[model samples]
Target: MAEKRTDRALDRTELIKQTTLELAQELGFTKLSIEAVAARAGVGKHTIYRRWPSKGALFLDALLPADAQALDIPNTGDIEADLRTQTYAAVDLLGRPPFGPLYQALLGEAQHDPSVAAALNERFIGPQAQRVRARLKLAQRQGQVAPELDLDLAFAILSGPLYFQFLIAQEIVTHGYIDRVFSALFAGMRPSP
Candidate 1:
């Protein structure tokens, strides 16, 4: 009997998470409310609060995939090639409208809500940022990048232009743009005199 109750609880949580994500995708995170999420999930508002104390916590939980795929960064032994691969992947992600809107909403909310910002930074940004840092370290080890290159700055250089083009300029991130950025970054960071 106890096991059955636990199973039901798990099922309810999964249902709520799925419903919240679907609603967030359809209606922008800024417009999502606990009452609406509860209605869509077919669960009571109290039930959601019991699982997560606040809407931000619940939203973060829903944002994460239950079977999230791990990113596989290629180590082609050519640092510039690997950086280009990573940057292109980021461009692809930013170009998708559904996800793009969701991210924009979250970022905007994060500006006002520290708790939500912390959760977003911890769960979403931190891991991806670490991946980029690791890739930079690998390049340094391979003697492809300058020994004194500031990795944080390198990351900015690799991703900043792409974000500007996609999010600000409202331009499509193309292969040519990625190639141009890669060329510029390599020119600056390549082993120098």
Candidate 2:
């Protein structure tokens, strides 16, 4: 009986989290409130407070995907092809509606809120960056890239143009842009005389 009760509680918490994310997507995080989330989740405000200490914490949890799969890079051992694949995946992630808006809001809020900034960095940015760095290191070892190339700088070189188009220019980061960038970057940074 106690086990069943615990399962029910866990289910309710999951529902609350899902509902909160939906609400946050529809209404910006700044306008979201515990009462609104509780109403959407069909739970009491106390239930939310019992689980999360602050709005930022709850919002952070909500922003996370339900399954939360890690970004996977294909290891074809062809540096340029692998990078193009990774760039496309990144553009796809950034172009999704709710996810895009939520990320933009997070970036904006992070500028003002230290706690939110830390949570965003820890949850999203750091893990993705680590994976990319590892891939870059592998490419270097394979002699597919220049030995003296900086991994961090390389990532910026590849992603910066996309970021400028999407975040600043409010333009779609198209397939053509990805191909062009990948071609240019790989050509300039290839291991050669």
Candidate 3:
């Protein structure tokens, strides 16, 4: 009986998370409310509050998977190949229904809201940024990149175009585009003979 209750609790938490993302996709994160999430999840508002303290916290919970890749960089002995793999993963993540718009919405919100910015930076961006930086250092050790390569600039070169297309150009982020991004950017960044 206790085990059944625990299973039910897990099911309820998942239901809340799913409904929150679904409604957030439909309604926009900024427009989504705890009341709506609770109503859709078929739970009381306190249930959500018990899990997440604020709208930002709830939405950040939903944001986790979108940014999960940031912490998981592959080391294939070939930096270029690893980057292609990672970029392709990002393309898939961004091309999905909720993530692209949700990401854009979050960025817009981050522009003015300190709490949102803090949440994104501390919980989302910082970890990934460190991971990428570490990956660049790995590339350096592997002689796949220049010993003198500016890690920050290299990362910017790798990710900046993708972000620009996603946020500014509002263009499609395809695997083909990822291919182009990897080819064009890394071609120039590869270590000199």
Q: Candidate 1, residue 21: CA error in Å? A: 2.1
Clash-forming residue pairs, model 1: none
The RMSD of every model to the true structure, in order and in angstroms, is: 2.2, 2.1, 3.0
lDDT of 2 by residue, 55-136 (tens): 7777777776536776677899887887788778878887888777777766776777788778777877777778788898
Model 3 lDDT-worst window of ten = 63-72
Identify the runs in model 2 with alpha carbons over 4 angstroms from their true place.
none
Q: What is the C-alpha local distance difference test score of each model? A: 0.79, 0.82, 0.80
The TM-score between candidate 3 and the true structure equals: 0.80
Ranking by lDDT: 2, 3, 1
Estimated TM-score per prediction? 0.87, 0.87, 0.80
**Candidate 3 per-residue lDDT over residues 67-164, each given as its tens digit:** 36453678888888877787777778878877878878778867777777888888767776777789889988888877888888877787788889
Model 3 C-alpha RMSD to native: 3.0
lDDT of 1 by residue, 2-113 (tens): 9999999999999998888888888878788999999988889999999887777777777655356535568888877776787677667767866666666666677778
After superposing candidate 1, which stretches have Cα over 4 Å from the reference?
Answer: none
Model 2, 77: alpha-carbon shift in Å? 1.1
